[model samples]
Target: MLRKKKITFVINYFYPDLAATSQLMTELTGYLQKDFTITVIAAQPGYAGENHQSKKLFEEGYVETIKVVRIKLPEVNKNSKVSRLKYISSYFFLANIALLKEKGTDVIFTISQPPVLGGLIGTIGKLLKRSKHVYSIHDFNPEQAQAVAYTNNQSVFKIAKIIDKLNCSYADQVLVVGEDMAETLRGRFEDETVPNYTVISNWTDEDAIVPIEKSEPAIRGFLETHGLKDKFIVMYSGNLGLYYDLENLIQVADKFREQPDIVFLFIGEGAVKERIQRYAAEKNLENVKFLPYQPKEFLKYSLNSADVHLVVNQKGIKGVSVPSKIYGVMAAGKPVLGVLEQGSEVQRLIFESGAGVVIEPQNYEGVIHAIHYLHSLDPGELKSMGLKGRAYLEENLTRATSINKYRQVLQAVADNSPLEHTFQPKQYKEVVHKK
Candidate 1:
């Protein structure tokens, strides 16, 4: 029996935007389109390089491949808190106006930071229209913001915590990226009546993960331009955000400047990205190179060039955060060397998959040791780790796996279908869908 659902997936950003978070949700919906009628309402200006002010807000007269409504958001520089609040309020007010024209949405989902505004708008819209609401928390807000020190200070975030807890408590379901974040949610509500919850792990496009000998120009240029063509290049590519204490890692690179064969390439942009670049330049770090971010379709080629991939983070922020890079690295089938806080999802993944080794964050000795240990591995051992990581990813983090879980959840609601059922295996060639 085919059934249609009036589902609204709300987020701060969407397609044509191309921010990491935006791409993730848009990718999720590509498969979900088969089951639900999705209406995505997002901001004009995104977290990354999408232009908002010059772009048209509503694609009013056109019915595109997907029914997405864009609301104009006044531009705000992501670096400042005051500007961010103003930006969030703009989305909040605009979405309220939008709700008046078209109301009944079965679920409302939002990514954590600036779009807490979306959560506020969805809460009001749900109550006003007598609809259900759900929050897709990519990152925890207010408190998690403080943990990363992305917020100005705790005192500045006190009032926001009150509102944030309200957003969590009011939602019908809480969807998080990792189990670590789910633990944080339980702490806030701590009460039995909390909403239904699920942890959806990160994913990477399986199709893009081809192991062709890296032929792409960017990958070749990156190696040749830096004289890294001969070196065993260990790369950490992606956003050099505040959440990562990368400047300290660069200090280690300064020490390894003599080992010019072992280069450290930091690609992508963020608040501290430029700062790290400047520090590397000031030290005249011959082994460290900074490159501009490119589109994700180009990322697989660049990622394939690395001999060993790095994921670094600040200490003590574990489970409170999950590095989205792990899944991508796994997808690329590369051995990982992660610098993360202990007792975290990153550590657990490394332990569970036997994919990578974890070095304590801020411990320059650990980083140096890991660099040497990873390089010391025989080619066969390294390949085995990579194989394990890719196998784990294929089993757990693919688009099909996530979508099936989502369908299970939604079907339970849409059909009053109970999830508590015993499983029985048929034949080895058992058919899930008999054609």
Candidate 2:
């Protein structure tokens, strides 16, 4: 029997980690395991402050048949730059060591996490193991950092960008999660040889997170437990991070404080989370509530409890990042109140799916109006609109669809052959640019 080609995934988070990337990668690797012998190099579970018990530099384990190596990393306080630097540097150094220890790797797969270090790991693995490297860019750093003005130092940004561009150039194949991101990849090498890249959309588990009626016991219980029962819940259910403009959006919540029935629910943690929480507290925004990240198993129940979901990104994050939370919102058949840039990938999905209304980022007035407009819609109309997004997801963006594309891509790369199938984005750029 022919041995299955081995693929080593060097990523920051994995199964049991509550971060969006962790869940996505867990599902992805699970599905890919059928065809490839899989190994994952990841940091200990800490995306949601899960406790780590191991003192060893590396702890080995298995997620079914897949091998996993979890590196011991310092606890990261997202708010502190010093803490984050320690965590990133530790993961980068140890993950490189872990990758070198793997034997007979045919493909090295890594995502864009910890900025350039994630891609650098894959590039280094490919060089030492003489394997094909598949770099999946979830967010383009320096660009994403620049989008939100996270840092004002142009010199640091320039150095980071140069390093990441080199990592991309070294990869055998590059996979971007959004069409807009593919354009960003092209922009990286203007008037030069662009690396071989493909646009593959991210996905949520359709089977696992199917739409459930709010009246369902699990959904109802979650709502009641959170004091959201019968409230007009406007939920933002992912990272309360730097990119979403949540700081200003919290003020938008303050505007609705007069309406006792309206609730603005935020259900995750990030660097800016405390700042947002502090602002809400200072303003005494009783309508807004913040919760910690929910377990992966409880995601569907928590998602179904929302009336309308807020899918957003910062203004300049058009191609720099795509919020993956939108998929879960769509999967739960919830209408979206998108605060996304015009022509951005998630914005296009919302428009095409007819899932919900969209307002441009930073348009606080537009957000207020959109919220009122959605709140006024008939219950049946809202349900129907949300179902449209579910329908779109089922037809075009199912997990199986994306997993199969990945399998094909990996197989082709393993064989050192040209990709036979190229997944395109249905003329999105043309449609958006024509307007």
Candidate 3:
């Protein structure tokens, strides 16, 4: 039997951690384990919850073949920019110490987590392991920092740009989650020798999150537990963080305070979560609810509890970030009301799938108008829109589709051969689902 090539992933967090990036890395490594002897070097869990022991080599129950190695770093919550950087820098400092102990790897996969530092660590890991490197951009670094006004240091920005450029230039294959992001990457290194790049989008496990009737016991029970039963639920699930203009949605909820049936639910934690909570409480908005993220197993019920889903992005964040929750909402067969920029990839998906309505960011009136329009729709019509979204998700954004792309890329890089398949961006007109 041919031995499987080894591929070690260097990330800040991994399985048992609920971060979007952590869960994504878990899913990717889990799926890739069949073809690769998978190993993950991650931080001792800190971002979301309690810390687990920094075990040397622990096997993941879900994927028995994969091994995880955790590193100890300063425990810091991402509550502020300075604190966040401290968290990132500590990981960069300690993770290198951890990587020196790693060997016998064919490829090193790292994401933009500790910002540009994660890629730099991956580059170093590649050299130490004597393996090809694959740098995956989860979010653009210093640009994202600047977009959110996290820092105003020109010196810091210059340093970040240099690190980012080096990571891209050093990697054997560069991976981005969306086409808009790919365009952003191209723009970043326009004058330099461009690296091999591909758009392998984050995906949803369709089988796990399929449509369930609101009448279903699990779905109804979740709504009841949240005091959301029989309400026209407008849910904004996922991280309530920077680069998401959720303030506009909260304002819209205030406008609908008199409407007892309309409830605005914000799920997940982040830097702005407390601020939003305070704002809603000060306004005495009884129809609004905030909940922590549900376990992955309960996502199907939690997601199906919504009558319509909300996806919001901050202005000027088209390519800088992409909301990973959209695909899960799509898998749940739910219509979305996206408050995003015109050319954003989310807007493009909504328009193409006839899955939802797209309103520009920070448009409070537009948010109210969209809610009213969706509420006015016949039940059958709304269900049909959701059906269209699920169809598109299966065809384009399924886990199988994305994993296949990664498998092929890893295989090509392992064999030192040219990638056989590449997906290009195409334009499609907005499809309006007419009754």
Model 1 clashing residue pairs (backbone): none
Error of 1 at 421 (Å): 6.8
Can you give the lDDT of residue 227 in candidate 3?
92
Q: Compute the lDDT for candidate 3.
A: 0.83
TM-score of 2: 0.97
lDDT of 1 at 102: 61
Q: Which stretches of candidate 2 lie over 4 Å from their true place?
A: 423-435
Give candidate 1 regions above 4 Å deviation.
1-3, 51-64, 151-153, 214-218, 225-227, 414-435
lDDT of 1 by residue, 132-176 (tens): 666667766665567666657667688776777777677665567
Between 1 and 2, whose TM-score is larger?
Answer: 2
Colliding pairs, model 2: none
lDDT of 2 at 132: 88
Evaluate all candidate structures by whole-model CA lDDT and list the values in order: 0.70, 0.89, 0.83
Measured against the true structure, the TM-scores of the candidates, in listed sequence, are 0.88, 0.97, 0.93
